[model samples]
Target chain A: MTRNETVDVLIIGSGASGAAVAWSLAETRMNILCLEQGDWTRPTDFPANGRDWEARRYGDFAISPNERARVTDYPVNDADSPMKVANFNGVGGGTIFYTAHFPRLHPSDFRVRSLDGVASDWPIDYWALEPFFAENDRMMGVSGLAGDPGVPARDPPMPPIPLGRTGAAYARAMNRLGWHWWPSDTTVATTEYDGRAACINLGHCTPGCAQGAKASTDITYWPRALRAGVKLRPRCRVREITLNEHGMAAGAIYYDADGAECFQPAEMVILAANGIGTPRLLLNSASARCPDGLANSSGLVGRNLMLHPWPQVSGYVAETVDGGRGPMTSLWSKQFYETDPARDFVRGYTLQFARGAGPVAEAVDSLAAGRLPWGEGHHRAFRALLDHRLRIGIACEDLPEAHNRVTLDPELTDSDGIPAPKIDYRIGENTRRMMAHGIARATEIMEAAGATQIGVSPTLNSPGHLLGTARMGTDPEHSVVNPWGRCHDVRNLFIVDGSIWVTSGGVNPTSTIQALALYIADRIKQRLATLFDPG
Target chain B: METSQDSGLSALEIDALRRLAGVLIPPDAALAMPGADDPDILADLLATLGRDQARVQAALGALLAAGFAAAAPAEAETLARSRMATAGPEAGTLGRVILQCYYRDPRVLRALGQDPRPPFPGGHVLEQGDWSLLDPVRARTPFWRDDRAGAA
Candidate 1:
């Protein structure tokens, strides 16, 4: 290793959780530093300007993690999983390719076991993260209406996006069905805040946002934290976290841009890597002291992986919906946000109405589904998918199962020769029942809205929310980390990403993920007396 | 290209594509849409599908043999479906890529009531439809669960 550098706190991965912690701890005036594997890409680097933009999406900016295997991206073995572990690896992490749908976990999500008699309960509750969620809303620049009856009371900072044609149709249907629907809290800005301009209604939020309107960490927290003296280093892929004589996290050994190994010694080490990356690092860090892996004394470091399965429903309409305009998702419903004894499943799902993709994407989508014809019939299908369609994404909540997990792949390795994560995930019975209910209800809503040609994709696609690999709980015997995000074994080592979630909530997990990181930073600051003290 | 200079295909394939391009994207003077065989446009398309040279060349061969350039639109389509389109997944993929390549071109986009420019640097300005479409939802009562007690 090269010269061992030291800092008060060293955070691995600068994604949503990492950025939240960085921003939270920046005020502490500690020597805080964050290392990100991916480069801090510029606005122009996004492929939105090219004429071959839609086609290039399948190659370079593909939503599939395996296809976009940049040097910074680690390969994932998703052979067994129904849905892929879809997350980007830059400073913004999934925010780079996210739809920016910011929804908080309901009060029921935190108390799943107590409420539903399935899955373990989170050590904390929705009330505990409520203030933090509000804090993140302002920080991330959420544009939405307050007074969403299903959600707890909290006001957004800006006005909501106009409920365009798609949202209007879906909302009218929800009204006719007497279901709960509201304008969604998207991270896209309607008005300017913190020097970032308003969202210009760009359609391709999935391939990265060039307008800087999306509240990705690179634009939101990284610059502010850097201004606050937090050193933000990129192109440094961390190999493993090292331990001291006391078996505390001493530092991390990482491969820098030049492929040279260097040790970053820190008074405290925080793992902000997501569900897959965090477990991959720990499993790769097998030493004599912790043969099973550091913080794997419970043998739960890479267990209980939860990837929310996405089932979608779509329909064709006569009116022009302007689907490719504004933010992708405009309206959402929490009518089934909680479970009922009537349903076979214990958990629930959220419905988000979005536009069908661009003309090229629609052509490919129709071809894949065997709906669109080639030759002379192509033009009609293209126009129908483009200007005359409405789509709803059903994000179902996945319960944590010990067998469905992220294990270290024995064969696959990244460009750095680091062992990649192997995902052995299959949808549980509960999720299947939930999806059936969700799809059936969504189809009815589509018909109610006078939409013809309604179709349902029952199988799962990318969940986009990867949680519960290194879960937090009250008991050390069954968990990797404690309630405060501290590793049960290593005092200074903290995991503050979706990896530490006890249960995966139905809605998007970014708001909760960021809130937990901020909560952990508070816990770390409060416990500074024993944060660095050895047993 | 002058004669598929950048395309990995042979001269015969280039000549075939030049003939088939007119049939694929016919010239429309009223809409100012040029045929797909326009040299600059064909070059761009060749560049777009360059990643799979073998598959594209196979499809081009099949289409040429199926009288794609000489037959009527429906007849040519039937001929393609019966002979070449059934070649395999590879042929179907090539056909789709070629069709998208034709449609996404600025010339075709302008014919389909769209701006000639790509959707970046500047995006579309869409009109927000009437909010009265939400009056039904706005009139409904709140449907939230009473509390966690009901769930528990």
Candidate 2:
């Protein structure tokens, strides 16, 4: 429709990574366009009631304009497509509902292949990215303790969250087990530093923080970018990245808010659309010149999909602990974070303790645990046990295998008329052994803590913290992007999200993603003169 | 009956629940709040519960019965006695089960300063530890300042 807009840089997906990059480059004076497939929802818009919140949690009655622009609901299967990745569809992307657990990857995590011979080593080391990580931490207002023995030492911008009953229990357990557990390095403000209020322990971080305590990108980076004059187009789903004659990124073709076709030209394109969408968009942008997929000369556009296998262990306590009343998870132990040759698994796993069971979710759990659906006895049992249940979750690192990849299913197409990302993944032997070990340790801890009953459940496709689709490496044959997160085939294109991760570290990926985004943004800024001069 | 014990299960509380249930039900349903003798009282409430004694005890309480029938002295007394009888550990597994369900019901949850909508907005029972983790954060500015200050 003869729609054309030009900018110095175009960022697809205003998520944790995209927003961070946009914010970092805010003062560059370069024209930047950040497109998000979700609407800009404010904290005040969240529902106060539990049922209404639950409905929104399931993405029901979400802002419809954004929904039509992007296909939010896609099926998750085990054999063909099995990744329960719940990404947010708004200006902030999944950061809106993400538990602000921003932990940096351990230094050894970068050189896993050298250290443990389990996974491939990252092209970039932790030292190279440390400055960016520190910068990102300060910018994002991370609250944590400095000099954590488990990882490198860095001063947190804010103080850590206080240890509550559960944290105390977890700490005691860790002490007894002689494991190294530390306060989570989260993005939530410990004290009133920024304009945002401090955490109130509302325990509803997943459905979006009404209290503005959880540090989502909207509250942290998006505002900074907006203030810096970075143009953010919400409800704009990028369909394809158009290339020039020289094979550089010309611009992007996207569906605007009204579902109309629009093309926005840019000197450079930084794809932070996440692992799944980033590769999907690249594959969809195939032309006669780039038939194998955009910037996919090595034929690894959507290869090496990695998801941190999540296995949960629930403990039923005797006292009315009220586990579900606070944040998602309060305490974590990285004692097993480093791989042990003594253990059967190649990679290690972290043990995180979270308060358990919202009423409805608790009911479902109870039903699963053989609680009778009805009768006086059933009701009594439910009430007596409601306050005493606690759950321990392990975000076990899954080794990257070439076989576990994200490919488009030729048979099924999403509502957006594009093939849905077909995730072919299974928990490898290393992860299964890790899960079993972690569960055994968790059961021991629970029993030691006087748990009357304990249950463990481990599944392959626990979607939240996804990584390693388009891995970064020194050689283009083995990876999609280079050590600097720049596309090996296309210099003008960059990937700063979880997609560029070479190894899925045991911790949450947000901190690492944000750090990489900052590093990449710095590189882009340094080369802005040559890249965006348009000579 | 001791008057002090009777005060806990006020006649008014029993009457309020009876009215509340009526509002929850569809207007088209002919099912009135069954009387004590109405065989369906056990069946209707226990139908969804199946053979679970806990569900039965929790659902077959003073507040639940009030919603089914018009307030009467005998009904109130019977409901109060049922509640007290199940209050003890001697009330067995069945009694404990019902007690738990009753407490979790939306009506009771609201009365206990809990928002049933967010389920447990302040956090769930297990969330106490999570709250503790946020304590360093919460101590600076509490999550429930308004509620703590007794302000709506």
Candidate 3:
């Protein structure tokens, strides 16, 4: 078919980064449109608690990209990678079911090569992105105390959500160990603000949030961006980026919801389709000028994939740690966040305490551990999992390595006849050593906190936090995008998602990901002079 | 027993699955909830997880043939433990489906001190809890090391 409609800018994926950019650019009176592969999930869809709500988590709301398996989604063959790609496809993307854990990247994280000496240094430092972090915090309405001395100091808009019994127990343990522990800088609102209702401490933040307390972009950025005038076309899966004679991104060819082909032309194209998704689109867009893929000048479009390997350890605390109550995880320690050469690990990890899963989930955990017996002692076996359990997740920072990557699978394709992403990754030696140290440290903490019958789980099948496929760098010969998120080969094309990450920090990437999008959007607004220049 | 329009279990398989549920969920003091073999729960399990009769028959048949249903509680527990020890993911998935069906019941939630209905619309009124526990961590300085990703 002919071109559907022409706009000043066209964005793909309406997730954290996409929403940030869309909201930022909507003000310039430019014709902006975002094409999403999935439909919008209404808040009403996720009730606080229903009979089958917990069951539905393993169903439609399942975090596994393969398990949720929406029509717009393609199965990721992650045979080699320890964790599968676990994200959603809809308007808010994975944020729809995320914990809304918001944390800033440290200044050391940006200059890792200069400071830590392992990973590549980001072209832009934490100071350059600090203002955007604060901006995002204000926009998302973060909840926590501002004086966290871990990074630079900044106050959150809302007060810290109550630590609860579980978090408090862990804090005491951290204090006993003389370690650094703090309330998480979460995106969940404590009191009602910005039209959304207050979080009622409902533990089911993952399946979905009924109260708009969680700062998923659909409820935060979409509403504002829509009001500010950005055309949103959902269920439109972009197939490839079509280029003009001058090798600039002219538009994209996509398959509409009806399985019909459509083309939307634009002066510029922004790809916020995430780490896995951004590369999937790039690899699929093969043409004459770029025989390998569109903007794959360096053949690094899908290289250096990073999924923070999280090893969760749990034990029975002396006091009740709140069985399936409050938010998922509100307390965390960054004591091991910095790399210690004495520890034999290149980079370090973080230990965050979580109130264990719901009743059904606990039962499953018990069974998986082979601790829950058949007839008698079932209750006794289950008490540690349900009530007095304090769970800690060891999140290790994964370094970028060429061998660990996402590539196109020739044997498998999605429902839309597009090649699916196949992952080939393994945790490097640095990460493994870090994980072992973290687990040992975690075990010690659990023991010190008067916990009994402590159980440390094997490495989770999937790490879940997928990042760094289309990594950014200063040189065009090595990275897919530049530090500014602009494709070095295709000036008119930009990728503002986690794909542009130079290094994966030891914490969650959502907060940093969204901030980078805002930073890039401002750059595009200011650099309008040579945006469409043929030079 | 409440029977939905869709229960893909055969009469023989249902009988076998029903018998095995008793061993899976035994009535105890703390767990005042219904047993897995309870008629309503059995029907619910059959209606939901019994979609693939072949798979259900295979797993349940293995347990029954090993005298898991008719044996004493102690003996049945032994058989189940042995079977589970030898069984693969199919057995794990089978047990998960059974436990999932058993726990979804309202009686189970009441026994666990939780409201029976879904958690939204009217949510839990949990306490802000004691803050003294956090005083120690709050009193100390942040522990992030000045070093970035240390040199390779």
Kindly list the per-residue Cα lDDT of model 2 for residues A1-535, writing each as its tens digit: 4467689889999988999999888889888989887778766666434443433432342322122223543332335534456566677776776778777787778878777776788878787788999888877788877656666668998877766666767666666665667778887776775788877766666667777777888888888889889999887778889889988889898777677888888888999888788888898889988997898988888777787878788878776664556666566777678767788877677777776655545654564455423322434455555657767888888788888877776776644556656678766888789888998988888887777668875233344465888888888888888777788877788898998898888888888899999998887778765653331
C-alpha lDDT score of every prediction, in listed order? 0.80, 0.67, 0.80
Q: How does residue A525 of candidate 3 score in lDDT?
A: 87
Angstrom error at residue A146, model 1: 0.7
**Model 2, runs deviating above 4 Å:** A48-51, A59-83, A371-376, A458-461, A530-535, B1-105, B110-152
Give the per-residue lDDT of model 1 (tens digit) for B131-151: 665555556555544335444
lDDT digits (tens) for residues B12-93 of candidate 3: 5566667667767776754586778888778777776633345556777788777765788677777876776567755766
Q: Could you give candidate 1's per-residue lDDT for residues A400-504 as a string of tens digits?
A: 989988888889998888889898987899999998899999999999888887887634666557889898986888988888899988888999999999888
Which DockQ-derived CAPRI band holds candidate 3?
A: medium
What's the residue-level lDDT of A213 in candidate 2?
A: 73
lDDT of 3 by residue, A1-535 (tens): 7578699999999999999999999999899999999999887788354676666666567788686776877789987777767788999987886777777777778767776788798888776787999899988889987656565678899988787777777777877887777788888889887988898877888767887788898988999999999989999999999999988899999999998888999999999898899898999999888988888989888888898888888888767677777788677777888767677877777777788677777887877776677776676677555777878889789899988888899888888898998999888898888888988999988987888767777547644677888878888898888877889899999999998898898888899999999999888888888764533
For candidate 3 chain B, the 10 contiguous residues with the lowest summed lDDT are: B143-152
Model 2, B43-151: lDDT tens digits are 2223323234333344445345544345475555455445434444322323332333333445545533456555333533332234333223322221111111233
Query: Ranking by TM-score, best first?
Result: 3, 1, 2
Best by TM-score: 3
What docking grade does candidate 2 earn?
incorrect
Lowest-scoring 10 consecutive residues by lDDT in candidate 3 chain A? A47-56
